[model samples]
Target: MIALVGLGLGYMTPTVVFDTFGIVSDTTGGAVPSAYVLALVVMALTATSYGKLVSVFPSAGSAYTYVREAMHPNLGFMVGWSSLLDYLLLPMVNALIVKLYVEQVFPTVPSWLVVVVYTVCTTTLVAITMRGTSRVNLVLLAAAITVMAVFVVIASYQLLQGEGAGTLVSTRAFAGPETTLPLVLTGATVVCFSFIGFDAVTMYAEEAKTPRTLPRAIMLTVLLGGGIFLVAAYVTQLRFPTNAPFGEFTDDPLPQIGHLVGGPLFQALLVGAAFVATVASGLASHASVARMLLVMGRNGALPGRGLRWINPRTHTPVVNIIIVGAVCLLAVDFSLELISACINFGALVAFTFVNASVIAHFAVRRRELRTAGEWVRNAIVPGVATLMTVLLWTQLHSDALIAGGVWAAIGLTYLLVYTRGLRRPMASLEE
Candidate 1:
């Protein structure tokens, strides 16, 4: 359970407070805390669905397993394929974040070069082995948490001393002058990136000591991570209520915020922490995605021909690791906002299906909704979760929908060709 919580929180890419803080801050029009608050509500609710599903399934497939068993297999495949956008591009997101920070230090360096170097380093490390990664990530997560607390204290001191927003606690921190429901929802969609790891706890269900422990860990992870994001965002928002001073750095504002509150030394410290986060998440996600693709390949869902190539000495699926790195290179051309929205599309798709699967499994399959207690647990909870997920989906950028749609469509075409009209059964996701 402890490891699961750490995994989930670390999976959130804790550096987001620095990486996309400015993007979400600008997107919400200074209502950064409110965006986080709204995102927390949505994720906290969705975590329930994840907890419940993990108890029943108790396996590593996550949303793919739940939806495939409860709903139709093809629909499950769609959810899994859409999820690739979330899993595969996460390493890219980390790379993009590293590029943004690296450019600040070496302004003359081409962005593409930074991404390529970062990707190559991460892929090489993971392709060889992942020993001691958990310990490294834990240390990194601790460092990030320490940095966050320092920033909050420093920013709070600045605010109390009449630096930015005057007062430390004000409504302005949550709602800016131009803040509206639509804008806040849009920001909420972006901040959902911070909560991406909560459902990941389900991946460890089988390893959990008890069925209930995994669900508990899932909720605990969401709540704990959300608490950290909210506290930091609140203080940061209070320190700089608007992006007016952000000018050109509105997309990646950590540098500006760090310099303002803690000067060059603190700025360097924060950047270092952000770099640590990128390395941890990048290596972890790279290793995980390579294995996921290998699973899909072995199941014949995706191309299996070359994915089976394990290096003789490393004993790793070197080809799949390289494929993962190649995908991360796309980060060179994608902006932080567009990449974030696109990933959110895939995550919301999986969230949508996970909630829907609960209804199908209990209310539809088992007819357990007859009793009031059963109705509330099996129907109302997941029903509201599905609705909230759809609400967030409605706010996703059009480009994200198109990108995710194109990916999903490609998966559908491949599945149709491979399955030959759903007459054959593919391998179970549990494998």
Candidate 2:
């Protein structure tokens, strides 16, 4: 349940949905659930591609790992570069979520201070004492889910008693006024942030009892995650059809919704759950990315002993952990909106290549698509998934496109220089 639920709906979905509801509502003209529906469809299709790829390359299989073996190493480096951007920003996003929860309670604490404390705590813990927190994280997940269930039940009760949207059964949440394809797609882009970690289960391909089970886990995680996301979006949309009543809280409606629906006690519980979830997610994302940086440094992709500096006593990458903490300080000035967009931008870039890797590995290179089923699984599914991901790309905000583009350009330039203008290959290539 944890390889990844610990990161999936158990962590990101509630936070993203509670955070993005207002954004999606404004963007989709009050049809947040509609956007979620679109995003879920896209993610489900992409999950199939992930399932296909991880089955073949089941050892610690990631987009970078799969594309490297199937396509070209240079291309895989580019995919890894893009994915690294997303991985790096996710911890910061969790910090921002912490800031929101802290701000909700304190109402006067500086956002910068909250982020600093959070960053320092998580970074220091991972560097000094990175022990198993799976049980603790699971307890937190249960607490959060319980709180959410209470909130939804209260919202449903109010709906029956004729409040807000005032009805339990209606298509208003899914197809409200002025909801168009572009608007919904734009909303989907924002909500896709919730599903970012659904594929993360594949990273544990090596640890899974069986290789076949790992890919299925990826697909199942996406589907189950989507179910939770849609239910939350649907109910919350009905309870608060638009962001008008939210006013300043439109940027973050979690606390405000709690108070409005069930008062301060419920509000505190909701914000508390947000804090627990963020801390769990923050620690996990921070350590994971820091170790990723350490690996890159050791492999010559990063070209620095600083990131490679392991603590003698703790045996963790102290330098890289601190570096990630410093990056998390970016949350002081960043909004959840822009950070999430940039992360999604990197995800889409990696996802597109992952789908291509499927075709390049099985359909094109293997040339074994004699049967209709093989052709559909290896070629057509991934082909359509690639298109779906590209469509989501068109919906990304301008700032994200620019940010991701610049990062990709830097990676491409670095690859060219490191490979002697593509004549040589990336470092550590024994193959």
The candidate scoring highest on lDDT is 1
Q: Estimate each model's TM-score.
A: 0.94, 0.94
Error of model 2, residue 77, in angstroms: 1.0
Clash pairs of candidate 2? Answer: none
Candidate 2, after superposition: displacement of residue 188 in Å? 0.7
Of candidate 2, the 10-residue stretch with the lowest lDDT total is 6-15
lDDT of each: 0.82, 0.80
Per-candidate clash tally: 0, 0
lDDT of candidate 2 over 68-143, digit per residue (tens): 7789878878888898898889889998888987787787998888888888888877777544544455567677
Model 2 residue 381 distance off true place after TM-score fit, in angstroms: 1.0
Candidate 2, superposed: residue stretches over 4 Å from native: 1-4, 10-13, 129-131, 306-315, 428-431
Q: After superposition, how far is residue 406 of candidate 2 from its true place, in Å?
A: 1.3
